[model samples]
Target: MDGRHSRISVLMFPWLAHGHISPFLELAKKLTKRNFHIYFCSTPVNLRPIKEKLPEKYSLSIQLVELHLPSLPELPPHYHTTNGLPPHLMPTLKKAFDMASPNFSTIVKNLRPDLLIYDFLQQWAPSIALSRNIPAVEFLPTNAAMTSFVIHLTKNPGVEFPFPEIYLRDNYAISKFQNVLESSANGIKDTERAVECCEQSSEIVLIKTFREIEAKYLDYLSELTGKKIVPVGPLVQDPVHEYDEKPGIMEWLNNKERSSTVFVSFGSEYFLSKEEMEEIAYGLEQSMVPFIWVVRFPGGAKVSLEMALPKGFLDRVGDGGMVVEGWAPQTKILEHSSIGGFSSHCGWSSVLESMKLGVPIIAMPMHLDQPINARLVEEVGMGLEVERDMNGKLKREEVAKVIREVVVEKAGESVRQKAKELKEKLISKGEEEIDEVVQEVVQLCRKKNRH
Candidate 1:
């Protein structure tokens, strides 16, 4: 190839999960349209489902390289991904991912990529770029608000429990933050470097959120990390429920009155406990609104759908409810006029989807950045969080109250209106930020000091 046509190539290796991988692919699509070449890497099992979903334009656009996750005795191939893995086994997966560094190093050496864009878990990636005389960036699919908060705390380790309400009201979240702090301070050997990879990068953190929503946080992040933080326009693609074509789902939704039914999903990962599921079931029954709720159990979870919920609960809401055992095409359902509200776990990606689609959120944040994301939704008037007890337990009555308020009551008209307004502003709007980010990335790559 001659110099005139040589395109700048970026090697992107996101963490082994759908939520982490999807946003990187969306950003890859935007980058490809700008004539940038991309080498997207992930485990084979994780890539299988999404490979077929790529559009024709993207068919040959990204070089999807499969990096086999080393199979450990404790966990098999399927367990490598966050979708099915139990919450407790996350540390095991992180260790397994770090063990694959030699494999990733081989690919980077062979490709000689101009830029290395890696997930927060793979801190060693930047070393490859350092060896090759180029720059690397840490691509965080997490929203800016949470990212900023974490970085700020990382910078100021002794800030007297910075966020009082979030930390005090939600002990689960506080505990998670404590883990992050302790881990960053002293995580295990393989992960300590990976977790701190953002600081190791050449002064640029590319996140899946824009400044319009969290400007203060973004500015604070820059000051905290001393890196030029770049906002990537909340890369939220319309959810394509791989199972949306399931004739029963759309048909059942069609039968319901407009804006009367909701699509309830707790994300692909984060399986609910039996107590949680039972409370949600009772709440749905009490809300008196029709819903299509998707439920998922952890890899080794022994409970059946019948065993998981309250006895006769299914029979009680027979016609009014549709319970899906696994994945559902959430985006397609949300697009349908029948999906008036989204009962979500408030994962950043899910939060962005609800915003982009104008579907109001009934936030029930389980852990991690979710609690922070939930607060942002309420701060921006996009959704209403279901109030939790001091123990951080989600109650049936509160669930019923919020669900009815968001989907079926006159009192929540403003919240509903604000959600739709956000959709129009985010989705129906121009691609100015989307287009501008590519230019910013190009400039970042062009900077001469990295090598």
Candidate 2:
């Protein structure tokens, strides 16, 4: 090891889900590329997949440190992958963090890294960083709009009720059939705690969204925090499958008319139930459009797809559709010339990627801040949401109708055009300046440490 090379270690307790881990991993990779000796600390189970996914060259530069934690009761025994960390598991996760703080503190003290970057859910990291006088930064794995929404919700508690209520009333029929419970103030107390923790600590918050997209909200958040809101993102990589050969889907897509294919993926974590899967399959079949569908194997009784989908659904779609089971190159798929529309679970990353690639969206929000993302997409006039059934299930007919409207109907052309314009704004032929943002973040941490 040479003294010439600077070392920076990042400790992230991602919310035990793929959506959280993937963005953090991308950040870590970017930092590693900038000649930082990177140490990625995560749960032992979570670390394995990341290690497996890493290229041989990356493995040489990046070090993985696995922390042992007792199995979470909410997490099933077979659950090894990161997906959606259910809200009900928050208390258990908090307790785990409290328990791991001392161990993490010990590791930081021993390693003595230049800076510590953490995820939003890990409230204990800021306290640990403060104790050691090490500069820390929070990496939010969501868009600026959602981050701004969260910041506003923290400051004015009253607004949270109306936002979700308004979304439910205007977009989804679920709110009408079911008794929509207003979240107690206690529900967002953790967010307040996180903000307060940041306020007290000598750390800056680095959000993973662009200021160009959400300037006004970012400006307001910056003023409120009295800290810089650095939005350096839509952090994504070219869709290259390192482990496997490229699927012929891209070739098939290239043969089609420009912006004619609708790319459908539910992110890495969202698994559909069998009935839901069949409904979606039927809907796609009914729509009669060129589509790419990423399907995941069923997990449990909660949302099993094994029994739900009809026999030979894949065969039926045949040449018209491509069904990718695992690890589809999403970024590349979105960038494809044939991709005109995105039917998504409204994960922030997927939404940003679709928008960045200039694809209009049909948002089917499953849970979490998905509804919020859906609203933002719709407000921007580049997307539409499917109506939910009385029991909160998305029927095949509804999916078919929305797909037809977005992909087949004449009315969707305007939305498609608007999405393309937005894409042009984001994607440039010139060099991307993400490294500059990384350097700024590094410099800010150094300045904070000197103080």
Candidate 3:
């Protein structure tokens, strides 16, 4: 059992959510090609689907490690992930996750990997790693623009963010961001957790962003935190690995004219309220644009699409629009030639997907860093935001107008072209970001060994 292998062993742990785990998995895949062996760890519930996404070649380089959270009455084993958990149980889930620190400690001690790459919320992970003489780096799956904005607000309460383009204007969004910052679990607020995680990072904080789009934000984030902000590129999932096999959805996309249709999805975690859903439904109908909308409800919720959406929605938009219940192969849909625009909630992962695939965005941010991400979307010229009222309520007219312009109007030509150019630029860069990431990570591990 002597350490003779050249491959670096890394234990990768991300938050128990599809968005966070996905980037970690993609980064793991990238590192595997550079002589890095990843022990991918997450709850059994979250790991099940990820197992299927891994190709046969990655089987040896990447090993799935089960992280068992204690079973709580409110949060059962199945609810270990944020995928289908009820909205009200979010706090319970976070508390349960905090309670699992001791369990994670055991995994770290037993595995004794040379390095640990952990998510933002779990500051204790780095603490445990340091105790075992293992260097831990924080890998934030969110973009730098939003990350810097949050940090600026926290550090300079009254100071205005230097970058005015990325800001929350609506009162509703501003209040929502404040509420999230103050929201606490286990007697600690989310902001405090983020600060601690950043402070504990070995020397560099690895983030999911590239310099081309966020060079200033990255530099400012480094200034604020005094940690080298190393971007790991987009870490986009390969469309080939997305083997869910949605033949029906793909066939529908195939029938649409090139760049004639829009794809509407609000990410896996967010479930729109009935009022919001009705407004969006009316907006989509009014836009007269062909769309593939994927609607999701909370886990175990009995509300069907017919019940959630406006009555007769299915009948009225028949053939012109497709309303899919639960899940859709989003990556596959975006890669299709027919998907001209994406009406998205601007979740970081979804934003990156649309950007990488050259699909312009009609940003309708819901909450929690999304509004900021939406602002970045517009700032980058790859998308336009659907303006909301002063109170932050979404209007059907505005939604319809934005959807039409971004997908069909001549005014949107620049944005569409910008998206296409971004896709090409990303393709040209290839794995450049990951190479820097590998160098920083390997150097950190070597430094730890020397100490």
Candidate 4:
């Protein structure tokens, strides 16, 4: 081994979604800045898009490790969009992890790295790293509040509440729900076994969130784990692309009154059904707010919008609205002056970006950690959740109500002010702190090597 070399391997099971992959990749880039060699592993299918976006300077240091899985049968007719994985694929992913563990073990042995950092879903990582005497850390792309909640749930089992229900309960009750979800999901049951694997093997749990923002919950988790819990985050930054400026939206925003526009994006991963799309469109039109709605084209099993939107919906909105299909420059859009509020699926990266921009949120959490994020945002008095019935179908009126609450009500102003304050705090810390976090990780790895 080259004693002076700062090398670490990062394994990520991307699970066919950009939301999961992007933050992990960002963390890898951050580590690269600290002179660490990163072995970025993913499925062959996910490599293509990442390759297109990666800058030339860092390309050599980031190595791609590809794993091939037998293609399962096509997704069911009703649910094939990017919003979520097919239910059957969960077991398939578990099986694939089991199959890949030995292969990953061989890679680690050959590379002989000092540390292994992996995503929450990679069940084999902790075991493989531990067997080789390397320290393993779990990188959660979700908010710290959710991480604290999950960790709490894992320690104290048996709490029953959906995300919204939990939020309605008192602050302490919310804490209990967090613990319940974590323990139930990562407890003695089938799902909890993987978390058990991580807890047993890992030396530390590294989360991507700020300690100042979620201090109470972080303290709770630190007490429960009896291990160091580090919060190294707001891990996302605006990608420096060379494309021409898309300032047209800003000009349109200036024409409108302040806080008049509602920005609707379900992130790159979630897709709306034709029926759901129509409902959203009609609801937006009914609400009479100037808006920007971003939607992706027919990819996977999503319905095309050639005939789905209400008749003359585009014409009626005219300069008042814009529909950006495919990729929209999200950071710039959120930073615009006239853009008043966000309607989001509560992806952590998006949540952080919105918080940094001081935009109030209309959170419509779809799956995974989203519901938990929604609860945190609302709890902090910065946002409101659009109520969803037990069936998971969102009504148009409810959408309208939440949008009005966030965009038109006095409560939203407090949320927006708090969000801006948080953003300023992050900025005051500067980019140098980000470098320090990555350096600390490298230092930890080097410490492991000496032993």
Please, what is the TM-score per model? 0.91, 0.83, 0.96, 0.83
Query: lDDT (CA) for every model shown?
Result: 0.79, 0.69, 0.91, 0.67
- Predicted structure 3, TM vs. truth: 0.96
Write the residue-wise lDDT of candidate 1 on 230-334 in tens digits. Answer: 888767775554663577988899899989987899988788888899889999999999999999986676778888889988899999999988767778888
Of the two candidates 1 and 4, the one with more favorable TM-score, higher being better, is 1
- How many residue pairs clash in model 3? 0
Tens digits of per-residue lDDT, candidate 2, 341-449, equal 8999888988878877888999888766687778778877888888776567788888988888887689888888888887787776222435555666667666755
Model 2: residues with Cα > 4 Å off, grouped in runs: 1-13, 71-81, 84-94, 159-193, 197-203, 243-255, 300-306, 311-316, 389-391, 429-436, 448-451
Candidate 2 overall Cα lDDT vs. reference? 0.69
Best by TM-score: 3
Model 3 CA lDDT for position 132: 90
Residue 369 accuracy (lDDT) in model 3? 88
Clashing residue pairs in all predictions, respectively, total 1, 5, 0, 8
Query: Could you say which candidate leads in lDDT?
Result: 3
Task: Kindly list the per-residue Cα lDDT of model 3 for residues 1-451, writing each as its tens digit.
Answer: 2223378999999999888999999999998888889999999999998788679999999999998888988888999998888767888888899999999999998998999999989889999999999999999999999898888888899999998887787887888788778887878888989999999999999999999999999999999999999999999887774445556788888899999999999999898988889999999999999999999887778987778888898999989999888878888889999999999999999999988999999999998889899999999999999988877889999999999999999999999999999999999998899888888887888888788
lDDT, residue 367, model 1? 74
Clashing pairs in 4: 152-179, 153-179, 153-180, 153-183, 154-182, 154-183, 186-192, 187-192
